[model samples]
Structures are given as C-alpha cells and as structure tokens.
Target: MRQRVVVRHSPVHGRGVFALKALEAGERILEYKGELIAWKVAVRQHRKQGVSGHTWFFGLTDGRVIDGGQRGNSARWLNHSCEANCEAIEIDDRVFIHALAAIAPGEELFLDYQLITDEPADDEIRLGYACRCGAPGCRGTMLAASDS
Candidate 1:
C-alpha cells in the first residue's frame, strides 16, 4: 500500500510528518505509536539520556504515556502548531492523528500538542517548551494555554 505520510526536515522543529496526498478534513491519518510506559520511567529515561526541551511522550487517559522515542513511527514526527491543520484523538489507550482541515500534498502535518504540565509554567519552564511553529497566533509555548 502507498504511504499516506512522510517524515522530513521541518522548519518548525527537528522533523515533521508531511501529507503525501490531499487529505480532507476529518480524515484519519496515522496512529501515534510507541512503547507503553509509566510517567516515572519516562522521566527517569529522559533525565538519564540528558534529553530536554522537545520530547515525544504522548499521555494517555489511563495515566500511562507512549514513549515515542522508544518505538515511535512517522506519526511521532508530527509537530505542534497553534493553528494546526491536524489534531490528535485518543481512543482507548492509543492516539490517532486526524486532519482538522483540508490539507494539500507536501503540507507538513501539525497537532496542537496542548501539553499539560505538572508544575507551574513559569518563564523558565515556558521558555523550555517555546513554540517555533510560527503560526499566526502562535502561543509561544507548547504547554497548554492555561499554563501559559
């Protein structure tokens, strides 16, 4: 079967998923796949690896997180955008990426990573998650708006 998405260098960040063909709004694109792990383990792994700033941890409603860096797919390349053309939907413990609006071929897919944080989003923390999406209404941070 032909692939629907491709991972490539992104001006927004390190890598990004791009549409290979025109996708209509509401189209189911890809599943955000990864190894299931506890938050503590994920944190410990991140610290041990000395990784900070951008991460590919997708939190599930069940209190577990998908450590995309462990066994992620092209969907893990999806970047964050304030005016995103796609969105992530959680179903059962898996997350799916769906188009929020019509997308053209070669367009980079984006999700509004509304990442919630455990601590207050002070300037220091906020800067750590700073948004480089350059969306018209970019919120400047990847954390949830409430945190900003």
Candidate 2:
C-alpha cells in the first residue's frame, strides 16, 4: 500500500483494494485523529433522529472528545464485515487497527465495526446498509440492539 493512500479493487468487498502493491502482514493501513469526547457528551450529540448512527468515542490529547461519527479520518470510512481482516484498538485513548493476518495487495481491508462495541444503544439504529461482510451465516441486518 502507498504511504498516504492505497487503492485496490476488493473482490470480497465489491471493488475494493486490488493490489495497490504487495502489502506485508500486520502493516499500518491508516490513522484516525480528532478530539475524544466523554460517553455522555457523545451520546447527547449523536442522539439525533432515525438512522443517524455513530462508530466510537475517544478521549483526546487536547482534552476534547473525538466522535468517529462527527470527526474521524479514513479509518472512519472503512466499511464493516463480519468476517473481517483487520481490527480496531485503543492505546492510550488513540484508536487504530492492525491486520490480523497477511493481507494481499489487492484485498479489501475489512474490520468488524462491532468489534469495538458489544451492542448498540437502545435508540441507536440503522437506515439501510445491510451487513454483507461475507461472513458465514451473517445476520442480514447491520443494525442490532435497536430501541424501536
């Protein structure tokens, strides 16, 4: 993958990464940077009407909250898959992902967005995007733990 950006047509993920170049296993894909807000504040701001969802909340270096929903980097754009190839972790409040195994150059990097969360909040909901992570016996709906 390139230093800044990597482009590939992912077979597993409908036109994703396609060998942007031979990438090593456990390589750094991208970074998500922004403020980190407390759970209370994040829930308040993100608690909008229907379909509007959020990813994760983090405590920032500048003493602010960075909600992956409102302000996040490329990692935020990465889609979710049940059979994921990547992972998300928080070290000292900084969130990141590491390849679980060797990812081929052209393979689309995938991570289960749910890995960071056990279950969605009561009011948290999904609009349309269904879960097609290609994982075995996947629950068709991506939105789980819905209040409505």
Candidate 3:
C-alpha cells in the first residue's frame, strides 16, 4: 500500500507531516513510536539535554512518556495547531494519531498539544512556551489552561 503521509518543511513550524492522499475523519493515520521511559526518566533526560522550544516527549496514560527523539517515526513531525485536524489517542500504552476531520491531499496534519502543567500559567511560563499556530483563536501559548 502507498504511504498515507509525508514529511516536509512546514509553514506552521519546522518539519510537518502532510497527507499524501485524502484521509477520512476518524482514520488512524500512524503510531507515535519512540523509546518508552518512565516519567521521571523522561524529565531527567529532557533536562539533561537542555532541550527547549520543540520536544518529542509524548506523555502516556500511565504516567510514562514516549521519547520520540530517540527512535521515533514520522509521527514525531506532526506540528501543534490550535485549529488541529488530528488528535492523538492513547490506548493500552500506545499512541495513535487519528484524523479529527477529513483531510485533503497535501494538507499538513496537526495535533492540539493541550500540554498540561502543574505550575501556574504565569507570564514567564507562557513566554517560555509561546505558540505560533496562527489559528483564529490561538491562545498564544501551548500550555493548557491551568486547572488551579
């Protein structure tokens, strides 16, 4: 079977995954594969690497995280968008990026990285994690609204 997507330079961000063919809503696009690690380990590795801005660490339902930077696939290229066309579904400790809406050929796939944090959404935190999705209602930051 032909590949359903391709990775290329993205106007939204760095590299982005685009549809090679029309995709129907609810179609399972691809798996977010990577090295599975404990949440603490992922945190330590991220800190040790001094990585910022972009990240490939996807959180799992069980508190573990997928370090996509290690052994990730094309799924790691998906960019964040406030108006997203895809959604990441975690099932049985695995993550699948599924189409949230019908996507046409050459359209870039996006996932709403509703990244949650325990810290307060202060000015410093917001500026550090600023977003440039350019969506109509973009919240200006990738960090999810603080629950506290």
lDDT of each: 0.80, 0.53, 0.80
Ranking by lDDT: 3, 1, 2
TM-score of each: 0.84, 0.59, 0.84
Query: Model 2 lDDT vs. the true structure?
Result: 0.53
User: What TM-score would candidate 2 get against the native?
Assistant: 0.59
Candidate 1 error regions (>4 Å): 40-54, 122-124
Cα deviation in Å at residue 113, candidate 3? 1.4
Local lDDT at 37 for model 3: 83
RMSD of each: 2.5, 5.8, 2.5
Q: Write the per-residue lDDT of candidate 1 for residues 9-45, one digit (tens) a residue.
A: 9887888899999999999999999999985575556
Give per-residue CA lDDT, model 3, range 1-97, as digits (tens).
3589999999978799999999999999999999988866755565565525456777775667788888899998888888899999998888999
lDDT, residue 44, candidate 3: 58
What's the lDDT for candidate 1?
0.80
Model 1 TM-score, all chains together: 0.84
lDDT of 3: 0.80
